[model samples]
Target: MAGLTVAALGVVGFLGYQAAATAPDHPTQARPGSHASQSKEKDKDRGRQKKKSTALPAASGTGERVVYALDDKRVWLVGADGKATRTFEVGPSPASPDPGTYAVTSRNEGGVGSDGVQVEHVVVFHSEGGVVFGFSAAVDGSMPDPNARKRTGAVRESRADGSALWEFAEVGTKVVVIP
Candidate 1:
């Protein structure tokens, strides 16, 4: 009976270790230089490598362009080499723009949005159904909750991402929308 109990204890410990090893990505508590810690580091590197090797969908468009995925709620700034230079998440309004190619028709450094918030990095692309669609970030680094009853087509992004978009996109810059 004693021998059987010891064997069960060893099996339980090994199973617990195995479960931790195969767990999802999260901060690990392994001691430094331990095999567990080393494996965790390797796993993180693998994740980053995977992201680097994965290319944006071909329908995102060719050459330099801003690719917006409506379904994914993400945006990619594609460089001339047809690779994404910057990718970030965006919070699009309920009335999201249709999936189609567009051009940045105008821009404003700062302006008052329909939601009564002071916004910056205003890049207007299209207007439809009495709604003027554009991307903007509140000057105070806040997101806008536009009035649903009124015309609101603002696509809100993080302050840092909004700055990058403002600098890269200019008048006539191509904006591709993917479903």
Candidate 2:
């Protein structure tokens, strides 16, 4: 009986030693160069690449003219001296029915109202010396609403010095000048 008890005690002691040995130590704080740190570094690198890829180029020019191009659309702006000052994107007014002529007007009065009323008027303005230089698309359905009469695509404007004024969407489309 004594021998049997000794054997049982030995087995229990071994099990206890194993359980204590395998118990996890107090959770240690993560050290630098750990897996988490490596992952963070990788994320930062990806962010840097994304920013570089999406950066816009600086504009370039020195004359008084400005030319803008977005996709297949283009526009040219010239100063009184025939110098280009600014080029921008613009779409046709809604009153035009031709598909090959681009036109713009200073009057904006027609559009689909929020209440579903078909308000009919031109919207959008490009002014030079108080003169409206409106632009239009040469196709039907190009300008659907007066309130949203700006070009419906990307727009990039550059000054005569090649400095970019703005790069955005639907610019120079809404809001017209009368005189």
Task: Pick the TM-score winner.
Answer: 1
Clashing pairs in 1: none
Per-residue alpha-carbon lDDT of candidate 1 for residues 71-159, written as tens digits (9 for 90 to 100): 66678899888988998877777577888999999999888976777888989888899778888888776665544665588887887
- Model 1 lDDT, full chain set: 0.83
**Candidate 2 lDDT tens digits, 36-56:** 577767989987864553222
lDDT leader: 1
* Candidate 1's TM-score: 0.67
TM-score, structure 2 vs. true: 0.21
Overlapping backbone residue pairs in candidate 1 total 0
Q: TM-score, each model? A: 0.67, 0.21
User: lDDT (0-100) at residue 84 of candidate 1?
Assistant: 89
